[model samples]
Target chain A: METVILMLGWVGVFAPVALGVIGSTIGCSRAGMSACGAMLDTESGYGKFVGISAMPSTQAVLGIVVMFTLNREINTLNAPGIFGVGILTGIALMLSAIHQGNSVASAINASKNKPEIFGLSIAPAAIVEGFAVFVFVFALVVSGAIPQ
Target chain B: MNSDQYITLMSALPSLGKTYHVDIPPISRFQLEKRLNLLTEEHQALLSDIESVLHWDHLNSHYDDSELIQSATLVLEQLTHKHYDTLREMILWRLNLRTILAGLRYRQRGDELNHQQSHWGVGDMEAHIETYWQHPYFNLQSRFHWIASVQESLQKNDTMQVERILFDVTWQYLQRCSSQHYFDFTAVVTYVLRWNLVSRWSSYDADKGVEHFQSLMAFALGEYQQLSMGIVVDQNGDSK
Candidate 1:
């Protein structure tokens, strides 16, 4: 039972990092494909596509931070709390990254043809990022409540 | 199709919105030349057609107004069909609408539909209009009904009003597609269609060009609202 609890704690500590990285990887690649396509259409504004493609990488970094924060000794009382928070937060970040990637891809596509809409097109992606931030903050605040 | 591929094709399209001006005289040689220069070499045939029309007008200085209108319509229809494959399917829909209108006019004049002057390359609605009107599909049936409602105006030979109705239907269809496929190729297709309509309207009547453009812009805003709501989903169940 003690070993199981300790294993559960380890799972909790690494879940966010694993899930977040997977999400970011998929997200970044999707956005990167769109950015590559945009480059073929426009002579300038390549920088914007590159920058938008990197947006999903932030979720992975946030996941790493959360994992570190939860990386203390494992116990039955705290194990479930860490496990729940880590898994839930990881899922939120993953979904947010994937969806945000799609939004950024759309922005890149739109702006490639009409450069004037560049700023306006990114608005949707930014809104999607906001949701990820909320999850990140919530996980951090709630993780502190678990008995160490 | 990929978003980038769609954007690349869209970027290749000429921006006629910038070239068309409400204050400019319609069909001036200089204006036509400017428009021709903006197009790629593939559209050289369209330029030649326009030149021929101008030459005919010059030779027959006393040409009747109806004759001039007919010639102009022929030139536009030919141009629309010239690069049919290169354009999006949405454009084919517009061309088909024009062909259908022409067919209606011919029928009202007691002329055979097969004797219509203009020929749409592919996706010609006239070729299968009977099937479209009688098809069991709900969407096709609805479209047929909508078009059928315009028969009264067609009977009266209100060509301008009929054309306006067709434009409205085309634009609304494009708007719906753009909204439903916000992150797909449809968005770019919608933009190009709007640009085409604006260019066509400006050339047809400079006085009403700006007003028509404003209405299109308003419609575009509504499309953008639909896009932002993330209600758009691809046919494959993907939220684009």
Candidate 2:
């Protein structure tokens, strides 16, 4: 049982980065495909489209930070707290990243046609990024409370 | 189809403004065809099947009502068997609208509802239409308010008005479907359909028509000059 808990603690410590990487991979590809396609239709503004496609990559960075914060000596006492916070934060980050990718793709598509709305169109993606940040901050705060 | 593939394919297409509002299509036919080449073979086949039933040119041929219904039924069955629920639904709705318009036309011509006509309608409302053939709007006006307007336009003998109303309704329906489907195969299909609508309306522009006519005339004159020169050369060759 102790071995199982320790294994889980290691898994939890790694989960945020793993899941966040997966999410970021999918999200970036999704938005990147859109950006590449939009480039075909437009004469200029290629830089902004490329920039939007990179928006989902932030989640991966946040996940890496969370993983580092959660990295410490594993034990039965700390395992459960780390496992719970780590896994939940990972899931939240993953979902937010994926959805943010979709939002970014939509924003790129819209603003490509109506250049005037370029700033406003990215608001949804920013909102999604905010949610991911919330998960990152709370996970950090909560991981500190885990028995060391 | 890969979701990313669809996102890319659709993003590459420029937005088609409101149907009938644009003086010309945002994208030319050549560019549209180039972009459509991005679709996978399977999706391309699926799009062709869907267009057969919904595109005006395909159905505007000299086919009778029964043949048209049969073709639509076969296509609908194929779409259903392939689990293309959205496409099947859109085609079904379009067929129903066609049936309503045909029924309205027949009634206007003073032709009594023929009992033997099983091929008249093609959707859930077909039975309702048969039962309510004597009623203007086929008793389905409450469900489809636009039917009344279509009937009124028909009465006025305003073909353009009828086409305009039908185009608007179809555009709105496509827009609704598009909302539910973003960055997917369905969205791509809806965009093509909307583009067709805009193209059709743009074709009605009198100025464009005159320009097209002038271009045709110039081409014809050029061809005639070439033919005359060829004939003169042939005569000279014979004399030699």
Candidate 3:
């Protein structure tokens, strides 16, 4: 049933959001004491990058919430590419979260070399997060204002 | 004329302004000269009053002269110049000693660490520290370049990072102390601020913890000043 497909898409989106949060949390912990002070040393050198890497996690949480509410309406819709978007977007949202965690880890590593320029390391990692933010925005468009 | 004016005119003595000083002396010429004269009279009066108390050595005294120390023993010898050079030279000399000693201590610890068990090895550690500390004699840009490099490397997930910053600084002459000072101040501030913003430091709400952040920034400024070369900020935040 179309309803089953939408429910399935919603489940897929939720899974990646959880995974991304888990990944970032793990990466942040491994990032040691960085930016927060005392917990990480300038000696460790990865604190600033870790600080930036840690921000994208909010996007993952945002994706899960949006996709869950839209799933029921998605089943009712019969528009072009609507169902396909639900499926593809669900997948992209999850991967986007994962991509963010990887990028966060990369940014944290960059902080190790340049501790003072934490902002620079954070900017690139934000690009990876752009994908998730973009996917979320696209899902809203595809859902056609949720017909509410 | 006021001592401030006299000091200013003396300071701007046509040939003296050739020095690459980044700032105009704080006092106006009228005020400078007045202050200088007042200081001279005070010097004479103090000496006349201290004929009985003049046995202590300024350089070897128990007191620390962190504030405005310039030696003037030669001038102090000139009944008019008594002890001015002693103070002038003392300030100049102590600053050099502090810079050198700090550099040396950093170098010695670095040598010991490399010879011990560092993954960076001795030569690389030596090279890295040499590079970090070989900083420009007088530009904040070059210094920021060094700071940015350290920040960038950490973001990229480079390994054995602590050693890299240490070595980078070590290469320059170990002038900056490598002992982690953030921990000393941040712990106290974080606890007092109550906002963790992160998983570990997540206990305090941001609104409740802003004071802590301010304190942390303040502390970092102190650390940065001590580590940088040739940049001097006085108590009132005037940079020289």
Candidate 4:
């Protein structure tokens, strides 16, 4: 029972990093594909696409920070709480990153054709990022309630 | 060609078409020359090909109405052919429909369908149009029911009614395609088609132009709905 609890606790601590990285990897690749396509269409706006493609990478960094914060002494009493918080938060970050990446890809595609809409087009991606931030902040807040 | 990039290119087409729209009546030779100059070098080359065939300078000076109409018809045929080679399948269908209509009209008037000048530059359709008209294999009959309807108009000898029916059929086809593939390149192609129709109708009747523009807005709404749904599927039907 002790070994099982410790294993669950460890899974909790590392879950955010693993899931976040997976999400970011997929997200960045999706956005990067669009950026590459945008570069082919226009001559001067390559920088914007490259920059937008990096948006999804933020979730991975957020995940890393959450994992570090969740790291603490593991026991049967708090293992379930830690596992629940960490796994759920990781899932949220992962899904948000994936969706945000899609939004950024669309922005890059739209702006490449009409450069005048570059700033406005980023609104959708930024809004998606806002949701990720909410999840990140809420996870940090809720993780504090779990007993060490 | 990612699906997103195709959609982006398509979304830009309406603005591009708007740039080509002219509001003035009886466009002057000077205005036409100026417009040609405004286009990119590639577009200018394409337009020059038509001008060379028409000898526009001589035609403009002579002001022969029948000759001008003939030249315009030839120019449309040439451009239609060129666009078929460059544009997507959806747009090629629209071009084919226009050619089919022109062929029907020519047949009704007992004009020589085999003449090179009368051809719309569609693949084998220019040569085998009569066979296709009579037999219409390969689902062409269902795809283009307008052919038979136009034949009825031909019997009545109502050229205006035939044109109206063709325009309606083309508009409905565009609307259907746009709604069915709202997230794909079809939506953008629909916009360009709508703009082209609006410009054509407006040149003839301002009320018709306004009506088509309203329909274009409806199609644009469908595009907006697809975007809001966030169903990002590529050309291969892979979702992100």
Question: Residue B78 of model 1: what lDDT?
Answer: 65
For the second chain, the TM-scores of the candidates in order are 0.42, 0.80, 0.18, 0.45
Candidate with better DockQ, 1 vs 2: 2
| TM-score, per-candidate, Cα-based | 0.53, 0.87, 0.30, 0.49
Can you write out model 3's per-residue Cα lDDT over B1-240, one digit (the tens) per residue? 232222222212111111112234323345423423423465435433322122122233233332212122222334334433333332233233333333334443454333342232111123334454544221223422444444444456553463345334432321111111111211111111111111122233466568866665666677675655335445446664
Two-chain complex of model 2, DockQ on C-alpha atoms against the true structure: 0.66
Q: Fnat for model 4?
A: 0.00
- Indicate the worst ten consecutive residues by lDDT in candidate 4 chain B: B11-20
RMSD to native for every prediction? Answer: 18.8, 7.7, 26.0, 19.4
Q: Compare candidates 1 and 3 on lDDT and give the better one.
A: 1
The sequence of per-residue lDDT tens digits that candidate 4 reaches over residues B110-226 is 775454354444433545576554443323666577777777887798877887887777667666665565334334435545555555655686687689667766666777757
* Alpha-carbon deviation at A123 in model 2, angstroms: 1.0
Q: Kindly provide the TM-score of model 4 when superposed on the true structure, using C-alpha atoms.
A: 0.49
Across B146-169, the per-residue lDDT of candidate 1 in tens digits comes to: 456466787777867876776667
Give me the TM-scores for chain A across all models, comma-separated: 0.95, 0.98, 0.61, 0.95
- The TM-score of chain B in candidate 3 is 0.18
lDDT, model 4:
0.65
The candidate that wins on TM-score is 2
Model 1 spans > 4 angstroms off: A1-6, A113-117, B1-153, B156-165, B185-240
What are the Cα lDDT values of the candidates? 0.64, 0.86, 0.40, 0.65
Model 1 lDDT, residue B228, Cα: 52
In Å, residue A141's CA in model 2 sits off its true spot by 1.0
Quick one: ranking by lDDT, best first?
2, 4, 1, 3
Which candidate gets the maximum DockQ versus the true structure? 2
